[model samples]
Target: MVAFHASALDGVARNPALPTPLLLRLLAFDGGGDGPPRYAPQRAGLPESAVAVILAHPNPGARVDFAMSKLAEPAQRARLVDDPSPKVRAALAYGPEWGDPRASVALPDDVCARLLDDPDPSVRTALLDSPHLAPSFVASLATHHDPAARQVAARAWEKLAPDERLALLTDPDPEVRRVAALGQCRRDAHLTAELLRDPQFAAEALRRGLLHRADAERHVAERTHLAALAENPSLPADLVERLAVDPDEGVRLAVSLRPELDETRRMAIDFTVGDLDRGDGVHWVREGLADPEVLRRAATSAHPLLRRSAARSPHLPPDLLHLLARVEDPVVENRLGIHHPDTPEEVLMRVYARLGGTFSAWMAETHPRFPREGLAARYADHPDGNYRRLAVRDPAATPTLIERLSHDPTVWTRQAAVGDPRLPLHRLREALHVPELASSAGANPALPEDEMAAVLNRAGVPA
Candidate 1:
């Protein structure tokens, strides 16, 4: 055994791919089962003779190690069933051998039965990880004193009879019940009714169309279930219609966001003119006000809030959009800029003129319909550096204008100038000499490869 450990260590040091049989032989001789065994020999990789030698070892620790080896035959494993050491039996009961199908002793009924009665909680818990564990054994674990063991048993829910599944639904352990409620057991009305009382199961119950209208209503009334109830396909249309006008804004908003919207249901939710014109309230009504007449009323309302909300509707007539565009309120103008993408060039020009140089005006100027001619030049000398930067980035920027900005004292403008695709390669090379522009100029794709290398070399940066 000492020779085998030394030879195994030598083989590992030299080849590193030393076979499992050699390693298991070394483990059998190591005398180190002070804690649970850590390694399981692969059955396919180790010869049966090696498994026999380890199984017959005088050291209980060696027997414990061999008991868990996947290579141990069922009859050989059975011999350890009554072994004097609990640790050896425990190792046999919960080891990798039970989980692997190719292992000769994998999930044998007798072995599982023996482990089930074993005092070790770990052995019982480990038994649950077996895919081949019988339903009867799983049923026996349902009443396990350990909550964790009961939870593990709950995972075999599909294999449990309906009566057995129903019994677990009322299990003292909430986790066990949670698992049971989500299992494949028949979700009859009784089970549904019982689960509906718990918020955790209520959402899933609603999703599966298990709850009746009265039960669903009770669940939805709770703030916790409002969002889930909205998403529940089983929610009755009448209830959905009722929920649309629910006093809770959150509940109403949840209803509004549902994927399917029928016309009657749409009208029932008051997102239109008569509803309170709260700023966020507009979002709830946005989808409902699809009619052109409703949108026009909203667009023309005395309240700028309603008008701003109305401006967001895609159905608004062009005339209403033109009118909203000319409204002096910055909020209304900004909303128009965002929602009125198809605004006529004349209206955009008029809005830009009225708004002066505000962000909304800049948005108008950047619109594709707005004339590009002289636009960049107009903002090029604007006092705001942001406008100047935008002007430098404009497609209308001329080579001379780009070069002028390249020498601007502002580092950002200079950076923008160096980044311009139209900057001549020769000008880019010259700009590299300016320390501030050097990094940006060097990184520019237009800079010649040789010149980029020289610049990087001068900066002491490795290629």
Candidate 2:
């Protein structure tokens, strides 16, 4: 049999008139050592019986290869749509040829219907891309149980009937409704009003002009709706002003931070210390508070939480920051350490002198103008490992100081020394045998390429 198949291959290669089934059988055989058969027939030229034989091949690879080939008849491709193999169906569904409307023109309605109910979501999704799919069938898949299918249907939203689009507005899937709301609800005021009741769709509706002033007035009464409404940039100034004091601190805080608020409106908006208790509200208010006076008041408020909130404000005056620095509160101290750029130099020096024992390491590593020289000199022999590490990383660190730090008992200090640009290659070479320092030493640009290559090669690593 093997000899016969081998001879058939040579004959088919020599003559084009050989039967395609014989050519396909030879191609499907796994010629272990004799090398693969050479007869390759184009799908369009293959007989229907030959195409069927390829599709029926037990190996999915053979079926996929054939499905991916060009077929002369849509019916031939349609026959495999219900082949009980999801992968086979998927290949036909997503094939580029099906993207052209003419390729699906001869496909029977029963075949298109079976593809719509295909168990694989990907097959259903790819079916939606077929230009010849009926509008009614596309609409049916719009609410298909699979969110992925509905997501595809949402892209064809404009082609769906008005009622079909409305049905999807409340589809169980949030993503499906979100897509539908953005595409279909913009022009229908009634549908827009209905979607506004759902917080997920409210903001999009308002931004698209689907929600009018009356809709905003009616929906603003609901707190859930207020969050989305607060983000709408086009809300009337008067309505925004009304919402600025909507009794819900969330609403007030949202309104206060809107960039659309003019100077007078922003200044007029009020937030009590209680508003700072809501973590999210305070975060947004702190980020948006531009009024120096409000920030100053919050900075000096008797309530520590309120003061902490104010201290976090990026817009706080440098003078207020200096004042807040002296409060001795950990929260206030940490905030000051991070926002120290605008603080007065004298205040920074004073804070460094007073709390240098506690925050010196962090300040040295992070502060732009941190007294690197002062800290290095002051903490050169500090007992704290972090302080020692910071000293090694400081710009004032001498090569000798780094060399001494390289021999520190702590691995962290050794790791820090490995990263220091001033560490001599000789010192790095000494540390290479230490497994912990290998990665850092290997990455150092100062290490000679040839030396690093030799070190990595000795460690059984590719250079």
Cα lDDT tens digits, model 2, 188-287, are 6676777666666666676443557787777665555575576555577787878887888766666665644555666576755442434423433365
Using alpha carbons, what is the TM-score of model 1? 0.38
State model 1's lDDT: 0.59
Kindly report which residue pairs in candidate 2 clash with one another: none
Give Cα-based local distance difference scores for all models: 0.59, 0.60
TM-score of each: 0.38, 0.41
Model 1, 56-152: lDDT tens digits are 6566766675566655465566567667777777777666443322123455666777776667665665566655455666766677676666776
Query: What shift in Å separates residue 198 of candidate 2 from its native position after superposition?
Result: 6.3
